[model samples]
Target: MENEEETLLKSQDSVEKRLGRTTLLDSGEDFEMLEEVDDGVDDDLPPLEDAGGGRKESHQANKTVKEITDPSQCPPQEEWLDVLGNGQLRKKVVEAGSSPDSKPQRGQNVTINLKTTLTDGTTVEEESNVSFTLGDGDVIQALDLTVQLMEMGEKALIEAKAKYAYGALGSSSTPVVPPNADLILEVHLLSAVDAPDLELLPPSERISLASRKREQGNVHYQRGDYAFAVNSYGIALQITEASSKVDISPQEEEELLDVKLKCLNNMAAAQLKLDHYEAALRSCVSVLAYQPDNIKALFRQGKVLALQGEYADAIRSLKRALKLDPSNKTIHAELSKLVKKHSEQKGAEQAMYKKMLGNPPDINTVQKPQAKSSWSISWKWLFGATAVAIGGVALSVVIAARN
Candidate 1:
């Protein structure tokens, strides 16, 4: 079977040929190579399912659509124009909106009716009257990026390359998208309005929005899309932190702080998955700043520190977490592994230095031969005996004289 990356390349080629184009997107970077991009994420961290607990049903689980795998049956791509001029995203207008002059801008609240289908004519998701805030990470990056360019009352068919769509890990939504699969979307923009400032929204609404983003992050994380997960978590943090700038009841304040900290903790985990150690460390520190006793934050801080080779600091952070949650076996195991690894690292350094310096002379061993030589020992005994005889003779003469 062709791998996901190969499938992506083949699919893009097919689409490009159908559109009478040589290349649809930048072919300079392979999708697999894109996955290797430096992010501070650590590969050694536990897989999403293991670290995040059991998977939750995708929020869009109810939006399942029937699959159609006939390769020859697809929408015509002749009129498709590259939206971003980068070939990664393309669109063909099916119906023009009423207000062409008024397009949705970033941070605007937009409502749309959308039907999503795979290239094989499989309608994966169809929903009417969906609403989200633009650039808030409430929707896929492709939709958010493309929709802002859409005119009010416009209906268009969007063809997104995998990078801007569900990406490498794909989507776990109903009709499950395979990894690296491109996305086909039929979207109708119903309405677009200025989004309320996060500070202007009711405390409850802000919390709800932030919580939803956090859940969205969880979905992305479970699908092994750490980059998207990190983005979603970051949005949640922004929402919660923005809400903090406005005065609110103590209860609301506490709730917002809790949500913010949760986002920070989850963001750190996603960052770790991306191998972004410094960013992950910052996220962990942010969470700890709000709640010093946060076990998750401390534990993540330890992991990040350890990954960055700050073993001593890592040990301190883990120990702090262990002090709070002494019964946590995960923390205990992580701490033990860190301690053992640190010891091995120290031992390796010592051995390296010793090898470089060579062995030093031992003072006791150097003097031992001279001190214990047979001739030296014999001479000492002879000298002592002669001295004793001389003293004895003198004493005898003295005694004889006295007698």
Candidate 2:
């Protein structure tokens, strides 16, 4: 059966999120719609209290988030660290994480399961798993920082003070977060991988990548992994299209053509295996359009046509392929079977027509015969020798009357 399995594997709830359009600023800060998340370990986490018994005030004369002038009533975060000078955020490493070496970077895709809460300890958001690229600004700046610091399989607690979070504006997805409210985030990092930006690579390098992907698809195909093969071949095709720039050398053009031809053949084979007849036919046709007499294209095209019950057209395609590759046993076997099926189909059609309306007018003489006369049923000598007439009174009366 034809299936749709992409190359990248994903855990449940761990796919990319849809944050709105993000514009990267000149300050290297990503500003986008961010998801609200918080640690769920504690149901009654205390609200963030200003060290001065209210919102922290800066001493830069503007009363920004930095300069804490008063230390009146502050919520104690014993395990948390204020790595940056600003009191706007704090981080607590819940688990150092199983994978010790690697963590998400500035421009990589990360997948994790996360939960978020408000300062009053009400759960606002949670995902069993999700994925997003770091530094994309599809989320708030605090999340990007948190993921960057997390290693694979690690869990952490992130407290984004109102300044680094919704600020005074709050969030668009939910109505719970009041203006200037802080957020708590807890996450379990599942995986972090580098997301490819294919457009950035040069044409030759893209072609090389495409070729490698195509080979990978072939491996998948050989193992009867049609779904994976389809995805792999699709990637190769995308890269091939990217490399097809208008300003290419003649040799490069030839190289790309060869690559495209092989890719089409492989893709068609996989699609056919998966019973995606229409897509497989299209791929084969595309190859034929480039190189009309390609044996593999012709051969696969015939198989697709046969599957559609177009035996006559299939026979022609198969015969053409056989002419090109006479020694190929596979082609020979398929063509022979198709020939027999075509003959049988024609015979059945004629039989059905005859059964419905009898044979054609010219063939109707088989049932015609001339009528035989009644005189032919008797001999002449039996006329006067009838036993019933010998003793008949009518004959005697006629004889007496005549006398």
lDDT against the true structure, each candidate = 0.74, 0.65
Worst 10 contiguous positions by lDDT, candidate 2: 12-21
Give the per-residue lDDT digits (tens) of candidate 2, residues 290-359: 9999998999999899999999999999999999989988889888888999999999999998899886
Per-residue lDDT of candidate 1, residues 72-96 (tens digit): 5544455576756688887766676
Best-matching candidate per TM-score: 1
Q: List candidate 1 segments past 4 Å from native.
A: 1-78, 85-88, 161-163, 167-170, 175-183, 243-247, 361-403
Off by more than 4 A, model 2: 1-200, 243-247, 359-403
Over all chains combined, what TM-score does candidate 1 have? 0.70
Best by lDDT: 1
| Clash counts for all predictions | 12, 9
Estimated TM-score per prediction? 0.70, 0.46
